[model samples]
Target: MNRYKHRAYNEELMDDLTAGGPSMDQTLRELETINRWLGGNFVTIDGLVKLLKKSPSRPLVIADLGCGGGDILKLVARWASKKKLEVELVGFDANPHIIEYAKENCKEFKNIRFEVQDIFSEEFKQREFDIILCTLFTHHFTEKQLTGIFRQFKSQAKIGVVINDLHRHPLAYHSIKLLVNLFSKSEMVKNDGPLSVLRAFKRKELVQLMNDAEIDRFTLQWMWAFRWQLVF
Candidate 1:
């Protein structure tokens, strides 16, 4: 079977988000470097900058779904500080262990905090954010799951959403496999890096997903390093 023909069912080590320790910590650290070097981090930042243009006044609340180690939130925090934009940034993940680690990782930023939130839960739905971000997230679920998630996100985000996720392609798969093998010592990072590409979305799939969720106003652009920047 051609695994790339569909979202791969193969599980990644990061799937068990509850499992965290030195290895997961190392994985988080390495991912930060990879994202920064590959220019992936800027995708989210730029999307946010556009949203910021709409409303420069008042404090904005931003929540990151499936936030890993809170590194992205740290970037958002820094940007807000520099721009003098007051933002209450919250990083949400279902994994308590990861949330704990993220909390520790972002201790220096007083305005940023971490929370354990299941995106589909009632508790999550009741809460609202000015902008919701899902960086390298959303690909972890199947089509049905994402459709439902889109609905939830639309309801929760007061402003809009910024999604930075992988694009399923051969080059992305092979390139990540090669890069991880060369620099990663953690087995989880080595195995999951390539698998993530296999589980990512294609542009057409994203369009269909948006239609299903009744989301009409949105911009979907392909980014360098094989990523999709979907801003809604």
Candidate 2:
């Protein structure tokens, strides 16, 4: 199948698979497992930290686009706190349920705020965020949608945008299946995990997509088994 066709198939399949509502606990646990598997080597977080350390004069404002349940936002918050940097975090997700959960679960962090807004919508201010970070997301888009999203990111971000996502490979697909079976009992996870890996973009594919989106001045890096990063 072509890339777009495969992406559509994966999207439909995932929606069907996860239709029954995987509990917050199950979703968080699966995310934790995935994070551990990725070795907490989120290049976006590390890259933002590097940027902040280099420029000590300004406080950083970061938006976690598609921040489901705020797991990665919490990590970003914790990392920022550890680095003793002043960071204003905004977690944006299309899912209202996830936004509510994030607000309640991550209430301890005063600097982090959750908002229900579509990343593609014009509701958010343009060029307001210092860095826009997306994690374990973006595979849901085709090249056209990706280009549109990048345009929005470019308009909404002042310094740069960071994208972290899975790299599709047969090995990664099998690994996800094995790991999900080993760690989770949710049928939604068991089905969606492997499909997500299959739907993920390869490193070169992502680079080409970035190029097609006219995002030329960015650094591409890989981590652990399948995670890839595009830092601008």
Candidate 3:
């Protein structure tokens, strides 16, 4: 087994600053599919279900950070609708094109909307959300950045924060490496899929980061398909 336990900051093709086109859109679509099949969406859904329990009577306002295709937000919106719960869902992403794509894809859901936002900006810090959900997003940041981000999340979220992200392990890395190479059509997917695993966290690493962020009231659970479901 490979024994290294440090985060790798390799550049993912999908993170290309100047990249925006049909291929970028295709890659995002593929990522949504992967999340669906790998049960990545369920991780956040489960956390949301728990968070919803805290304030059952109030109208809920939820925000999904780094919402590429807004798939998770759409799923949450549908779940809330089916339960007859009054809820508003918002999706945030820094890329304008991705935000446009998310809006177009989620146009059928009136309760869900998209916004272009830098999560670290003063505007984001000023806004308050009942529940903030992050899926497969935290791995993109360094530990120092994550500490600051988590602290902000604690300050801005009124109810709680749900973080669903990859677990870095030799098995996870190799399994995704094989699966993406075989099933993905986009070059960005073929490159970034495994790279994300390398950038992902170990359980201890997340625990330490949370400690550094000064967030104490939280539970971290290991979910299926190598995901960390953290609720704060």
Candidate 4:
């Protein structure tokens, strides 16, 4: 596999689910496990912490774009509760079933709500959010699409945006392949995990994309377990 070139987008099987079947739900739960153990949640929380330090206000509204299983937002809700900070966490997803799954998982947290909306649609563009989060979400798009998304994030986010995504590299790819094979039972997780690494970004490639998006006020850092923490 040529690590230098960006691979074509492969649709994740979980993205196509229309109903909450066992396999689909298992895949999402497995993904939440993978993210939690692999430092995915920490990276976004780090960015969120920085944002909170800058703007110490009550009732902070945060939107998790493409929130899968709503794990990250739920985690955020718990953290906010510990800090005694009032927050409204909204999860936006294109799939209704997925939204339902997330809502079920996060039902205990009254501060979190799930909404089914396409990110590229007019409603998403018109709506404003205090902080926009893209956690393990951006790699699915093409460079052009990412550029536009970044532009939209810049315009719509009042405080800023936090993106925690994969870093494509040979070591990261092979390590995840081995782990997925050993631990994952779901076919969707087995197939899409390594493919996600292929679809991920290099440091310079992300910088160029940010430049193309005309977004400069950002910090991109490589976090542990092959993730990029981009705070804008």
Candidate 5:
């Protein structure tokens, strides 16, 4: 396999989705259902808090890349409120529709801001945030694309970047496939769930990606049967 192949979502796919040929509402609904089943928010937020506890300074600004419907942002907001940790959250995604949905869903949290950003584009500012989080989103990128993202992330965040994504394993793949079918009937869930596992990274592959991106001052760990974390 060409590890450096650009497998991330292409402009054509984004254009097609933006053009309104398919039912976006249905797709979003399915995505939400799949996320819930995967328990991604629970795993990611808990892990983040654990990591933050070890640090001396509190994170003032956090950017949740690939924010999707802002579900994870909502969880982080709630957690921050309980901890009395004042934080400003910026949610970014390439899809405007998804960003709009995130905004609407997270309207109750005044601290959370949602915007459309292309991670691969030069328009994205650098070194402006305390932390940059890419959750359940990295599988979209191939080695080369991941390298570019990590470079951007390193330039943008002073503290470090947190990457919470899937891990590819045969057991995990089959389990999630069955779980999605048993839990959700959304076609999008059924389609993307399996594909996500297949496209996911292994621990060594993730570590190598970080190294290839020149991110040496960080640690990577795996959890939740198939979730991986890269923390610095």
Candidate 6:
């Protein structure tokens, strides 16, 4: 399976709503390590920093969609502290189990909160945030779904939306597959690691998605380890 080819629809094991407990906890924790090791978290951080530069003053609200375990939010909290930025952060996950886990994982941050909200729902559409973030999350949906989701984000976010996801390369797929197989114990990570690359976006595909979403102002940068940092 080449990433240059059409995206793979084969679902990742973690996509299952029923997945949880030790296996899910292990997968989430391992994912935190994997993202940190890959320098993946910084891609999202850079995008947020770009938006923050536009409006350094004024307290802001940031919403992280599909925030698994709220690991990225922790980094955001730390960054906010250093910058002395007054920011209110909230995390949203479709899975209630994941939401519950994220609450405990990010309990130290008094400025952060978590909620179980499906992106497609009316309640989510009604809510607005200054900056919306989706880190390694867009790949889970199809092109059509993403087009709609991006459109919603354009409406929901007052500043912009930050999207950090995979670049869809064969090396990314194979390397993650090998790395997870070598070091990961969770079955979900073992199955989802490679599958995510196959499901990820190409530059042209992302451009098409942006065009379809009617988003004209944006920046797309390819980052280290085959990651895409798209801020719109």
Best by lDDT: 6
Q: Write the per-residue lDDT of candidate 1 for residues 107-168, one digit (tens) a residue.
A: 99999988888887887789988999999988899889899999888888888899999999
The best-first sequence of candidates by TM-score reads 6, 1, 3, 4, 2, 5
Over 4 Å off in model 6, which ranges?
A: 1-3
The TM-score obtained by model 5 is 0.85
Could you tally the backbone clashes for each prediction? Answer: 0, 0, 0, 0, 2, 0
The 0-to-1 C-alpha lDDT of every candidate, in the order given, reads 0.90, 0.74, 0.89, 0.88, 0.73, 0.92
* lDDT tens per residue, model 3, 6-106: 88998787565566779888988999999889888899989988877754787889999999988998899888888888999999988888888899889
Worst 10 residues of 2 by lDDT: 12-21
* TM-score, structure 2 vs. true: 0.88
CA shift of 107, model 4, Å: 0.9
Query: Distance from true position, residue 22, model 6, in Å?
Result: 0.8
Clashes of 1: 0
Q: Specify the poorest-scoring 10-residue window by lDDT in model 6.
A: 1-10
**Regions more than 4 Å wrong, model 3:** 1-3
Report the alpha-carbon TM-score of model 6 versus the true structure.
Answer: 0.97
Report how far residue 49 has shifted in candidate 2, in Å.
Answer: 3.3
Comparing 1 and 3 on lDDT, the stronger one = 1
Give the runs in model 4 whose Cα sits over 4 Å from its true position: 17-20
Question: TM-score of the candidate numbered 3?
Answer: 0.96
Candidate 6 residue pairs in clash (backbone atoms < 3 Å): none
Tens-digit per-residue lDDT, 33-63, candidate 2: 6776667446667767655547556788889
lDDT of 4: 0.88
TM-score of each: 0.97, 0.88, 0.96, 0.96, 0.85, 0.97
